[model samples]
Target: MSSRFVFSIMTLLMTLISTSSAQAITLRGEIQPDRYTYYLTDQYAQKLWAMNRDRNRTIRFNLPPGELVAQTDVSFAYQHPAPTAITCISSIYYNQGARANWLKVACIDNNGLEYSTHQKWPDTSIAKRVCKVGEASCDAFLTMSSDNWSGPQ
Candidate 1:
């Protein structure tokens, strides 16, 4: 093979590898009605396994309240504690309606610990709170409350 042809092949291979590795994996799933339990698709599980191989600490992502739906994509942020370290979710709530009606959502960690946020109309800012890290696995969903809305207003 010509030297130039060999160089071109190596460059192409390198580019392919870099491109594939740079792509991030996103996990999609739904928070079941059970509220505390969540189900992840097989693809999500596989992707999580691949991503977790390089990590030593458990990771959690604070998904936006709007994104909690029948099906949602869950992606981890760059900021995470060691897989074994303690961490929690900080939430902020704002009033999303004009009436006295309010909505509160809670995220439950693997250990049954719950972090909640309350929002009333006109208060668009998220309420903030943190729950100490619990088990190795974590999941979150909206809890049914007087202020909870069946859907986005």
Candidate 2:
């Protein structure tokens, strides 16, 4: 039991398993655009004024591959009457070792109930990212919100 205390407990269990496998685990959540729904392409009726009764909002997300740092904050509100055109779009799909990449961002609403913030940095090779209500075919039930996205660190 004494070989220098078993080599200092095997070097402190291999430095706590390599510092907890090089620490970095963060994933978040918070999405509400009328509980998900997406399908639009009517060429945006009159620039999307609630697209005929909030055609169902949508957002999907998945990430696993490597390096990812993203942030998004979207807030929308509308009373619709040909103003308050909310458009929030975020799409990022990726693969690097075999070459594949797609990145898109559209957070529009230059006036009326607005709050849009989007960011992406440290993209070592993403894998998933999808948000909706762009091109406006629907999603105008307004009061939309978003926040869940940390990364595939």
Candidate 3:
């Protein structure tokens, strides 16, 4: 992705993050498809900003009151996932009354198939999402204790 594109994403993130005091915002860097690692660059308020290899989308998360993005309990369970070869991922967060804390994840699988879903932050139910996005391996959702085990759920 162009540095200008990346700069724009960072600027936008900083704007939103700076304005929100009601919720904590967490954004993830994109995966460098070739390196299979996070493409991290730029920082603000100690936060890192990045766009995916595809440079198409970005994602954010908002946790409950008093929770912080830096907290392991929160970020580990909800942050943008680590990069993988199976797919490229991006996400967005919406806050339109009643829709607050909703996160929509957009993915493009290795096959170039598109998939997306919106769910409330910090889901506490036993029902885990079962679908495929960006990654060919289905484990796109950040599951606590789950390693890089990519497989269709």
Candidate 4:
């Protein structure tokens, strides 16, 4: 084999090796109008990984140390009382006794999305979740059906 050809092959091999050894992780998660869950993976290239349900989709992600953010969608149906209130929550844990903060958006009776803060901290301090919102807890409003909530109507 020619010297130039041999050198090129070595360069390509080194590049591939470096890329594969990088420290990054992929994450997946799933969120319904009323529930959600997520998990992190081993770091791949200085990044953590997470995956969710439904989206059944995976994403390659990177975040600054001590910083985290997640986004997802949900669907819900109206009840007899109408103007139903829907509250959804999910939890996360890092170390055995690490503190983790959580933030989530809830979709209620198709009135649109509303954000809620973490009401109760889990026993582990690492896990974060939300409380339930019901008819009595939420104020009265118009109920939006699936069709009415979709597209230009």
Candidate 5:
């Protein structure tokens, strides 16, 4: 290959790498595993939701199927366990504990283990902005369904 062609290929490779990395969780996370379980916190989940919604402006994801829970355990997972999308985020309440801060969402279990539409998990900045809207929570009005990942309403 010509030197110029090689340089162009290298540049393209770098851009792709950086773009993919930008959407990654600031904390560590794994997208694939034979089996995995994620213990997400209220703050982190909300942040992910916010990022999901932003990326998919017209598309809305399905919330965890079923009724919301009174309270749930949140993990102090500084290194985000997985790229999660709430199974149910109809309403989020803070569940504080020595271990972690949880939400009141009693939805299905998904911890970025299995593949979904959002393979490239969004960064924490997006989720942070989402929680800012409601001070305490972000799923106040936001809603999702069990209809699976969507593409344009």
Candidate 6:
């Protein structure tokens, strides 16, 4: 091939590669024992922002399938002495809102424990939701565990 042709091809490839890869995102936030107990009312936005912004944030992850994205401001807590090390994975999936297959997200906190919850809404993409506890897992709603040293529920 000619030198000019080779140079043009290489330039095109470089441009395409650079254009395809956008800037890196950063996510950040805070979780408390009180607010974290029952899934936060703003967990959706908080997780999204953490994945898309706030550069140095921890717990970066993606959602699973059939999980609709909704906005809310409830609270939920975690059980732990926190893992010594953690991993964050992010992915996109469909959240079937009684309507259809819509894109949603799941942020898993693999910190030596499992903390899973779900929220529903009219639109999966739009931010605005009604939070529901354990509905995603097909489990009972949030409740104080029956087994407790302090007392009984």
- lDDT tens readout by residue for model 1, 1-153: 999999999999999977752332121232123222334344433333344333443334454443221111123322222121112222233334544443544443232222333331111122222222232453333323532556766
The segments of candidate 3 whose C-alpha lies over 4 angstroms from its true place after superposition are 1-92, 120-153
List candidate 1 stretches off by more than 4 Å: 1-35, 43-66, 69-97, 109-153
Q: What is the lDDT of candidate 4?
A: 0.31
Q: What would the per-residue lDDT of candidate 4 be over residues 12-104, giving only the tens digit for each residue?
A: 999998775232122123322333211112231012122112234333344333233222332211112221232234333232334443332
lDDT of each: 0.34, 0.35, 0.34, 0.31, 0.34, 0.32
Q: Select the stronger candidate by lDDT from 3 and 4.
A: 3
Q: Which runs of model 6 end up more than 4 angstroms from their true locations? A: 23-41, 49-153
Best candidate, TM-score-wise?
6
TM-score of 2: 0.23
**What lDDT is reached at residue 41 by model 1?**
40
The stretch of ten residues in a row with the least summed lDDT in candidate 6 is: 28-37
lDDT of 3 by residue, 1-153 (tens): 999999999999999988653332243343212211122122321231122222333344553431112212222223344222222233444557766554443333232222333442212121123233344444443322335668877
Stretches > 4 Å off in candidate 5: 24-78, 81-153
Number of the candidate with higher lDDT, 2 or 3: 2
| lDDT, residue 31, model 5 | 18
Would you estimate the TM-scores of all the predictions? 0.21, 0.23, 0.23, 0.20, 0.22, 0.23
Inter-residue clash pairs, candidate 2: 37-57
**Candidate number with the higher TM-score (3 or 6):** 6
Question: How many collisions between residues are there in candidate 2?
Answer: 1
Between candidates 2 and 4, the lDDT winner: 2
TM match of model 3 to true structure: 0.23
